[model samples]
Target: MFRTWMRFFTPGAVHHRLGLVCLGVGLQHGAVPAVGPRVLDGYVAVVISSGRGWYRTPDGRRTAVTAPALVWLTPGVPHHYGPDPDTGWDEGFVTFTGPDTATYTELGYIEPERPVVPLADASGPRDVIARIARAARQGNPLLEVETGAAVHELLVALRRARADLAPDGDPVLHALARDACTGMTVADHAARHGMTPAELRAAVRRVAGCSPKDYLIGIRLGRAQELLATTELSVAAVARRVGYDDPAYFSRLFTRRVGAAPVRFRAQQSRAVPDDWNEGLQEDAEPGPPVAEPVDGP
Candidate 1:
C-alpha cells in the first residue's frame, strides 16, 4: 500500500529569478512504478530514504538504487527508475527548474552524468526535505521563496552527503584557499600539493568549478576588495599586499574583472562605510549596489 502528500507550483517570472525555482515536491510509500525511459523538461531530485530500486539512463546504463541514495533526473534527459515491488520503498522528491542549474552542474553539486548517487547518510537531506514538505501547505504565501531557498540548501546537503566525499570535506580546497593570496602560479601551487598542473586543474574543476588560476585570482581580488574598502592603502601597497608587485598590472586586472578602477572602487566603497561602522551597522542591513545578473563562471 502507498501513502503520499504532494504539492505543485507555477511561479511567476519574478520567482524564477531566484535562480532555482521549485515546481513540485512529494513523498511516496509502498510499491512504485518504473519511471520513464523518457525525458523531462526540468530536473528532479529523488531521495530514497529506504527500500531498494533500480535506475537507468537512455544510453542503457543501469545502476542499482539503495536506501539513502539520490537519483538525478535532469532536463531533457531520459531516465527510468522505480522501487522493488516486493519490498516497496519510501521516497521524497522535488522537481525544480532554473537558470542556475548549469552553474550547479559545473560546480559538481548536481551530477547528471551519474544519475544515481549513494549517500553517506540521508538524515541531513531528509531533514531539509521535511522542511520543504511543511511549506507545501496550500495558501502558504511564502511557498515559492521558502522552497526555492531550500532547493539551494538541499543541493549543499546532497553534496555533503555524497558517499565519496571525505568526512571532513576536501582538504585541498582549504589548503588552496589558505594560500591563494600568495600569487602562486598554477604550476607552483600544484607542485606545493604534489600534483601536476593538469591534475590540479582537474581536481579543482571537479570540486570548485574553476581552474586553479581563476580560483586564486578570485581570492586575491576579494581580499583586495576588503582592503580597498576598509583601509587607506595606496594602489601600489594594496597591489603588493595581495601578492601583485606590479601595481599597474594589478589595477588593470582589477578594473577588468571588478568593473572599476582601484581608486574609483575604493572611493565608492569606503565612503559607504562610515568610520564607526561597527556602531552604525544594523544586524541585517548591509546594502550594496543593485544585484547583477548571473555571469559565466569557471
Candidate 2:
C-alpha cells in the first residue's frame, strides 16, 4: 500500500498563458477505485508507471489504462479515471495551464480530442512528474517557477516521444535537427553518418519535409532567433554562435527567412516580456532571397 499525495494551491497570475499556478501531483497504489465522473478547471496529465487501470470520458466512453501511457484531461472536460480494483497501479499526475495552452492545442501537441496517448518511453515523463511532486512537498521558494519549467520539459518529452512514433520518423534526422546549430556542411554530416549527401537529403526530406540543407538552416535560424531574443549578443556574434562565420551573409539570410533584420527583431523582442516575446514573430512568411546552396565549411 504505497501511496503519496501532494497538492498545491498556487497564487493566481503567477503565470499568464502557461502557468503552473495550481498542481495536484502524487503517486498512488493499492487497489484504489475509479475516481471522477467530474469536471476540472485546468489541464491534467496522468502517467501510469506500472500496473493497469481505466479512464472514463464525459461521453460515457471507458478506456483501459495500461502501463507507460499518458492520459490528458482537458480543462472544462468531464472525466473519470483510476486504478484497477484488483491490481491498483502506480500513477503520477500534474495539472497545469498557461496562455501557451491554446498554442499547444493548435499545434496538436496536446490533443484534447484524443485523451489517451501511448508513450513510447515513459521514464522521462515519470521523472518530471516526480520532480514536480518533490518541489511541491518541499514548499520550495521557486515552486511555481520550478513546476512550470518541469511542465514545459514534460511537454517537450511528450512531443519528441510522439514524433518518434510517427510512421516515417527517423531518429538520425531528429538528432540532426537538434544539432543543426553545429553548422556542419550537408556533405560532411552525411559522410560522418556513412551516408552519401543524396541519401541523407532524401532521408531528411522524408521526415522533415525539406532538403537537408534547408532543414539545417531552419534550425540555425531558429537558434539565432532565440539568441536574439534572450541575449545581448550582437548580430555578428549571434551569427557566429549559430555556425556562420560570415555575418553579412547570415544577416541577409535571417532577414529573408524571418521577415525582419536581426537588429530590428532583437529590438522588438527586447521590448516584450520574455514569455510573450515570440508572439510577434512571423511564421511561414514568404521566403526571402533564395537560400544559397550549402558550401563546405572552412
Candidate 3:
C-alpha cells in the first residue's frame, strides 16, 4: 500500500501537462472500467491494484493482469482493456509525455514501434501508480523529476523481482531469504545454514551477486520504503517501524543503503503528506524519546 501510494504521488510535481505531459487517469477501488480499443491522445500506464483484467494490443496480443500488476501502453497504440467480468477489478494509471518519455523509449521501457514489453511486476506496477498519484495531489515543484525517478525505480524493481522469480532456484538463495527476513546476525545466519560465516559469504556471493549483509539490507530497505511512502509516521517513527530502534542509526543506514535520508527520500518519491498531517494533527504533549537529528541533503 505504501509503495503504491509513493508511486502515485511521485509525479505530483507535474501540473501544466507540459508539451509532453504525465497525468493520472484516475484511481478506482471497486471495479475497473471497460476502456477502449482506440488510441489515447497520450501515453498510458495501466496498473491493477486489486482483482484481475485482460488487455489486447493493436496487434491482437493479449495479456492478463491480476492484483498488483502493471501493463504499460504507448501513445497512438490501439488497445482495449476491461476487468474480468466474473472477478471484478480495481485499477490505477498515469499518462505522461515529455522528455522522460524519450528516456523510457531509449531504455526500451517503452517501444515506439510497438507497445514493447508489457512489463509485469505486481509490486512495480502498484508502486509506480501510487507514486504518481501522490505527486499529483501534492502539486510539488519537483514533481516531474520525482516522477521520473519513480519511473526508474519501477524499472529496476521489475528487473530484480524478475530475477528472483527465475526458475533455477539456487540453493544459496534459501540462506539469503532467511537472513533478509529474520534480521539474523551473520554468525547466526551461517549457523542456520550449517556453514562458517566465511563459507556462507562465498556461497551467497557466487549466487546472489552481493554480500549477505548487503542483500539483507536491500530487503529491509525495500520494506522501509513501503512503510515510509504509505504511513503517516514521522521519520523516527517509521525508522522504528522498520526495525531500526535508533532513529539516527537508521537514518545513516538508510542513506547508505537507499542513497538518501528517509524524510527527503520519501518526499522525493511521493509528495502526499500523511492524512493526519494534512488534517493538522498535533503531536502529543507528553515527553518522549530523545529526538535524534535527521541528516541533511541527499
Candidate 1 least-lDDT 10 residues: 289-298
Encode model 1's per-residue lDDT on 108-158: one tens digit a residue: 999988889999988888888889999989899999999999999999999
lDDT of 2 by residue, 26-48 (tens): 67666766778888888888887
Cα lDDT for residue 137, model 3?
A: 53
lDDT of 3 by residue, 148-197 (tens): 55555654454443423443456666656644534356666677778888
Model 3 lDDT on a 0 to 1 scale: 0.60
Model 3 residue 101 CA deviation (Å) reads 3.2
Residue pairs clashing, model 2: 17-98, 17-99, 18-98, 18-99
Better of 1 and 3 by lDDT: 1
RMSD of each: 7.5, 10.3, 14.5
TM for candidate 3 is 0.43
Which 10-residue window in model 2 sums to the lowest lDDT?
283-292
lDDT of each: 0.83, 0.74, 0.60
TM-score winner: 1
Candidate 1 — what's its lDDT?
0.83
Cα deviation in Å at residue 223, candidate 2?
8.6
Model 2, global lDDT = 0.74
TM-scores of the candidates are 0.84, 0.62, 0.43
